[model samples]
Target: MIELGVLFGLLAAAVLALIFVLLRRGNGSTENADGLLVEQARRLQAHNDRVSYNAASVRSSSPTTTDHYRP
Candidate 1:
């Protein structure tokens, strides 16, 4: 139908306009900053140690005992 042709032309024009708008706005962001990613990789590797730990472990410091508390 002639109506169908007109509809397709309108849809194609809208899509082309949207593509131009996006091209002008350009692309988006970076996931990491500079050497931070490299340092993080090193830290992650160091953290991969066999010791089992979770958030609670990170929050707690080592237990401290004085001579008076000797077993």
Candidate 2:
């Protein structure tokens, strides 16, 4: 029972130390992150436009009528 208590106390102390270290670490600038996000958005928009254009072209070029059913 005493050994188990000592083990839990040591584990708790380690966890607290880790938390303290993480909290002490300062957050860096967001300028680079913002730039990256903006670039990603632009690329995504371009990809979407290309996809839309391809779909439109395929839809227009494909046959609309079925040979088995004639009106």
The TM-score of candidate 1 is 0.38
Tens digit of lDDT per residue, candidate 1, span 1-71? 99999999999999999999999988665566866788889888778752346443653544352344448
Return the TM-score for each candidate structure: 0.38, 0.40
Clashing pairs in 1: none
Q: Which stretches of candidate 1 lie over 4 Å from their true place?
A: 28-71
**What is every candidate's alpha-carbon RMSD to the true fold?**
12.8, 8.4
Residue-wise C-alpha lDDT for candidate 2, range 1-71, written one tens digit per residue: 99999999999999999999998886755656887799899999999888777744656543554444457
lDDT values of the candidates? 0.72, 0.80
How many clashes (backbone N, Cα, C below 3 Å) per candidate? 0, 0
